[model samples]
Target: MHNSSQPRTDAPSAASEPVIEVRGLAKEYRVFDKPEGLMASVTGLFNRKSRVVEALRGVDLRVEKGEFVAMLGPNGAGKTTFLKLLSGIITPTRGSATVLGSVPWERTDDFRRRFALVMGQRNQLWWDLPAAESFRLHKEIYRIDTPRFERTRDELVDLLDVRKLLLRPVRDLSLGERMKLELVAALLHEPEVLFLDEPTIGLDVVAQHALHRFLAHVQAERQMTVILTTHYMKDVAALCKRLVVVTQGSILYDGSLEQIVDRFTSHKIVTLDLDAPPDRAAIDRLGFPCEIRGPQVILRIDRTRIADVLPGILRGQGVRDVSVEDVPLEEIVAEMFRSGSTAGTDGATGAPR
Candidate 1:
């Protein structure tokens, strides 16, 4: 696992001015209700019912020029909507945002040239063409000078180790290979700001790690500001120092990864290796949930009660070894999603209800 605690020493310092900024940013879609039967569908064509779905609400964020921030949330949490708004692919229904000193929705050519958006589920490259051909097309569309374009393309291809796959049609390559090419294509112009919506989704572990290393290296080398939305905790842990969690179309937590764990998790897992199988009733009397696995007992103890409960557990009949650990980050995030509560960063007890 990557040591996420260590900051990237080679990364350039952030510029004095923010590369991206937003205030009260929100988006809503009028989703028309579909009728099931033919007659009902015909009736609905004349009198359709519709409801508003808020994809983002009152979101405010500022990202410096060299920052790599991860956006995390469950499905239908508006993460993708947020990215589209930032990338100018979709206009917001309300509020305002600026990327690289220009309003993103304005879609100016200059602004378009300064950023890239990569969605894992979507393909920007032509399916029937070789990736090499697509690269050439990108060069023309971006009006990149021949020499500079070659230099950037070669460097990106080498970094991602996808040179051999360049001649293969995008439809012929594996998902992982296609994704690597996608990254290369997205970076051929060397965009200063990158918007990635689950770029590693559906990738195998090896591919995920490869992309992680490649992204970390590129972000550091170019000092690009990146906003990545992913459900994978490993992605957040391996790549980003800052984490912003969104759910129910609102910002729930915005802080360091360590801070999220410290603030939102209320319990720790305590494992006990005993001399022998312990009495179930006696363990139950301890007032914490425990699972007995042969000679080992695992207990989920509230953080506040650990100090009070440890001494008694250690003094138990067969107590021999004990260790305490925080609950897994995946579980913590899962609980947050299940609870659907707004979390404040003011205190340690600010866990979602």
Candidate 2:
């Protein structure tokens, strides 16, 4: 965290340019192969065996200011690697990326100050020291003006309702409290771009909800650009309007949260909650894809069958409540990964309904 009265003097582009521009960005790691034999170990000094692991391959993307985009992927899909490259933690093996018009790997004072990254698995605060001490270190590191620092700190602490916890040791706080403090610490600089990597990882539902609310408020109030990688669909539904789904270090889909369902899933789910448990044979006779969970019968009906199937589903059932929804985003995304079809930035169309 570094700051200046005049920032980005060496920026290759103007403020009007995209907040982030990535072209053919890629990262690869040389992993050493170890052998058990003493003879092999003796020769390893002269000739070591290694294999290249491609963490990211030719990923092209652009992000505009004030947009909250979610990056979705499975384990080892390079989601973490992409964040590391963009945040300048590691150099890309090939291609290039410009963040706020400056190459991120440059690690310039101006460039570093403009972005903040929050990783759920890592802790930036001093474990033994009071959170306020860490907050002061941030102020000093960023060279934040005194009055401005105090104002910003107060605003953040108040927003998170952790004013009292600031003086408490970070290790003394619960996981949720520590996360709140981490958010405050990352945001004290008021970065223009925020990178969140599974920020809600281990939190219970209530804590996740609070953090989400705070994030939404901060993004809206400041119009800061945000790129987040998360597995929690709740976070996506609450924060992101756009999504970029990746698998095997390649982007599979990039579009609206809504379009993902339409593009990947050919069917919709209609849930029928019955007054009493219905006979399983009645549903089985329909010969439609359905599930029985207690008194509720969940149907996965093709789009064309909704009109015809809904009536038959409701005809003999003791329907107490009924609801219809597009296939869940999680299901659609999993499907997209399973079938590598169209789901790109240009609206890559998938199978027809």
Candidate 3:
């Protein structure tokens, strides 16, 4: 039987090397023009024109063993394209990528055995059959020995909390329940690397939190390398210590989330709730830019001047309640893209503060 405590080293290793190495990875798709009218359609069929949609343009990435990294970007920002290239689902048109020292698109049996890709929107389990049965079938497909399969399956079920739901048909399970089963099935063989594409997508808050905890546990206990692509900023912020932010088919901000915030915005929103609406002139006399919205007074205080400006606003306004908060990450990122602030260092690339 496989031991839960032992590290899985079944895959081929090139002198205990990095799990993944990518350089100048790029992919492009031909954009076909739709015919304007019936005559144009008939003509276009005969003489078609196309444009290049650069899904991923020269993305340079490297992932080490046992490191959990998150890839974040808005829709159509090349995050999915990059994951597909790494998983060998789609081949990159340029550059090179190696997973466990093997070319991803090569379809080698050894390489296939060493990794698992779990896509949240895609269902891998059989709809009609019990999830346990599907897992058993996959165990055979993976050729996992009885002892090893039992040990891994049991461990995954316990960790993912899907033991009771395993015998139920996959189609009958709730979204959260199905996700739990999917996780167990994917990890049944203890793949060295796990690629999660929106693994927490479409889940409720509680379900999302559950999955997040499970992922954290799996990372800590197994020491497996994971490359996650997620649009949910909360998932990225909570799980990922390092990150790569891709936009317009390129790596735009590839550092810490905190760095992104710090570099993009210097304005802090400080809210002060007053017992009564304060005078506009009195609020402005504090010498800081302030806005009165409802019963609250907000200040657009600069990061450098927040300390000096905050106390004055409260003391001057006779504040009943006060709060200090950095601008949301989403707003900062939006501003960065809108202002065209691409290709610059923010700060720590290793992890978020």
Going through the candidates in the order shown, the clash numbers are 0, 0, 0
- Shift of residue 3 alpha carbon in model 3, Å: 40
Q: Write the per-residue lDDT of candidate 1 for residues 207-324, one digit (tens) a residue.
A: 9999999999999999999999999999999999988777667766676777667778778899999999888887888889899898899999999999997998898777888999
TM-score of each: 0.89, 0.87, 0.87
TM-score of 1: 0.89
Per-residue CA lDDT of model 2 for 20-138, tens digit only, reads 88888888999999888999999998899999997877777778888898888777878999999999999999988899999999999999998999999899999999999999999
lDDT of each: 0.85, 0.83, 0.77
- lDDT score for residue 209 of model 2: 97
Estimate candidate 2's RMSD in Å: 6.9
In the predicted model 2, the residue pairs found to clash are none
- Report the alpha-carbon TM-score of model 3 versus the true structure: 0.87
**What is the alpha-carbon lDDT of model 1 when measured against the actual structure?**
0.85
lDDT of 3 at 24: 79
Better of 1 and 3 by lDDT: 1
Q: Give candidate 2 misplaced runs (Cα > 4 Å).
A: 1-16, 35-47, 274-281, 340-353
- By lDDT, the candidates rank as 1, 2, 3
Best-to-worst order by TM-score is 1, 2, 3
